[model samples]
Target: MRILVVEDEEAIAEGLKFNFEQEGYEVVVATDGHEALAAVSQTDAEEFALIVLDLMLPGLSGYEVLRELRQKQVMTPVLVLSARTLSEDKILAFDLGGDQYMTKPFALREILSRVKSLIHRHQSIRLSTPAAPADPAPAAEQSSSTQGSSPGRFQFGRVIVNFQTFQVSVGERVHSLTTLELELLKYFIEHQGEVLSRTRILNHVWDEHAEVTTRTIDNFVLRLRKLIEPDPSKPVHILSVRGTGYRFLPFPSSQDVTDEEFAE
Candidate 1:
């Protein structure tokens, strides 16, 4: 397995590289976010098994790097190591598609364990399912009858999602979804109408070794609502269960009303 460690701190970066190398895994170090992005671009983007990312960097902030990577649909699992312990910071990291996060003074053994677990889980998922094509046929070019008609595609209200391509469309406007957003949407569709607790979501969507807070889950839910809900202020699809968690209603009551009601 190969790992990329992106950190501006020389001592910390070297220590991680050394420890990871000792475990028989190849390690590459990048002192800044730009260098890290450059390295990923130069190599096979999918070749690296894991990435150790730091939030504070010289060239680009970790948030920017993470956002760009996800924008480009790079699915490499990222494990964030940062001194910032604020819930907001952690939430932002997860929202930007980070797979795991650890505080600055984290134990080396724990990091190693998390890395191994992430790699194993990722490989298992890949083996179980066909990897998405590097560049799928554009959704617009597909036959109208086949659009959102296959098992891999789904439609709700005016929104259409192509799971295989990670493409989402609202009405006629197409949008690119982050990896995490796509995963969460898929989970919701699979468990439609079931109330999902924050803990349940965190366990299912994030790395098992990740130290995630429920607040992070809330943030993600809010973002999803913005994308899928017709009126985010009065959400009818992703309904909060008061003290419980949230429920996903694929066909909300508002959309199910008769034509007479709509005419009224």
Candidate 2:
């Protein structure tokens, strides 16, 4: 797998590149956000498996790089690394469409684990629903457990997602999600209530051959909640796991389920 390491800290950048290469990945190193952006533009989306970004850098910041990339429709999964650990900072990264984020002072083992997980998750998504496979039978009642048999739409509470059209609706407003966001939401619905780590999301959502971090996952979730949650500020459905990662609270599956139960 080919991966990009974008960081101004020479030692840190070199360490990541060296370690990633040792793991049999092809590494591309960028010293600043501008260079990283240029690398992204020069490379095709299907080429590199992932990008590891640093928030603070010379020329442009990591946030800017991410924002611009998304604006230009770049979909390469990105893993953000920075010293900023504030919830707002993390939330901001999510708003810009980062796939995951990680703070500084992290262990090499943890980084490796995250990288492996992101790659695995992405591979799983690609495999799970291969390009609208041949029709199994006439369409009928569809449930989360039943693969590909429902009308394109799934509705619960104020949320509505159309699998065939890849559209999302929250309350009365309909919004379009990027391919990554759509896939992430589908995965969330399939495994609701489970606390998932950054590694786990990356393994299932991003390409398995890609390199990413947990922070990227947080960012994706933030973006997701902003669109789906009744109020992103006091999100009830997409609960946080404090310092760990995230979990999804599925809609009531039984009569005994309560509102709090559906959200918590």
Candidate 3:
């Protein structure tokens, strides 16, 4: 697999390239965020398996690089390796769609392990190429299970999501969702019409040991709202319940049209 190493420090970048190449990975070293972005956008450039990004860069900061990548709907898994150890830094990275994170002055072994894990997880989901959106289906009537395996396709309001392919459509717009985004949305769909606490979502979807705070959940919800809600400022499908957690209402009201009626 090919990996992009975006680090300005010469020694560190060379060391990582050497180690990753030894481990059977084809590594491309980009000394700054601009180079990394160029590598990704250039048509002849090869598709990368993963990216090891650094926050400090010459022309563009790693944060800007990651944000632009996600904004363009590039779902390549990114592992942030930065010196910023603050919780807020990590939170912003995740909010901007980073897949994994690690601090600098890092050990080579752990980096290799995380890179392998991220690549494996991303491939498991296939970061699929866009296909024709499937015919919209009625929302599931059964309760979404918190255990066992995740279900496949789900439609609510005008949104149609294929959990298997990571393809989603809202009205006429389609989106490529990150793995975490897909997981969180699936959890909401499974428990449709039920109020889910931020804590419970963190535990079930993020795992109990995840270091993220409830604010991360709020940010993710906001991102999801932009995709599925008609007016994010006045959201109807995913509702906020005062001081309690949020709720997912598949059919928020009587006047709303079924997805089938709006099919093209």
Of 2 and 3, the candidate ranking higher by lDDT: 3
Question: Could you estimate the TM-score for every candidate?
Answer: 0.74, 0.61, 0.74
**lDDT per residue, candidate 3, 1-264, as tens digits?**
889999999999999999999999998899987898888988433278888899989999999999999888787878889999899998999988987668877878788887887777667544332222222233364233311232456665467786666777887889888867877877776676666888888877663434478888888889898988898887777777656677776656543223332211
Better of 1 and 2 by TM-score: 1
Candidate 3: segments with Cα more than 4 A from true spot: 43-46, 107-109, 126-152, 193-195, 207-211, 241-244, 253-264
List model 1 lDDT by residue over 51-158, tens digit each.
999999998999999999988778787899999999889988988878778999889889999888777766554322222212234566545464333455776557
After superposition, the stretches of candidate 2 with alpha carbons farther than 4 Å from their true spots are 130-184, 191-222, 225-264
**Candidate 1: segments with Cα more than 4 A from true spot:** 21-25, 71-75, 120-179, 255-264
Estimate every model's Cα lDDT from 0 to 1. 0.76, 0.71, 0.75
lDDT of 2 by residue, 1-264 (tens): 898889899899899999999999999999987888888888785577778899988999999998898777666667788999887777787678776668888889888877776655555444443222232234564344433324555555567777544467776787755556878887777766677766788887765543345666766788888888777876766677655666766442333133443333
Query: Would you list the rank order by lDDT, best first?
Result: 1, 3, 2
The CA lDDT at 215 in model 2 is: 62
Which residue pairs in model 3 clash with each other? 144-190
Query: What TM-score does model 2 achieve against the real structure?
Result: 0.61
Candidate 1 at residue 248, lDDT?
A: 74
What lDDT does candidate 3 reach at residue 137?
Answer: 35
Model 3 lDDT on a 0 to 1 scale: 0.75
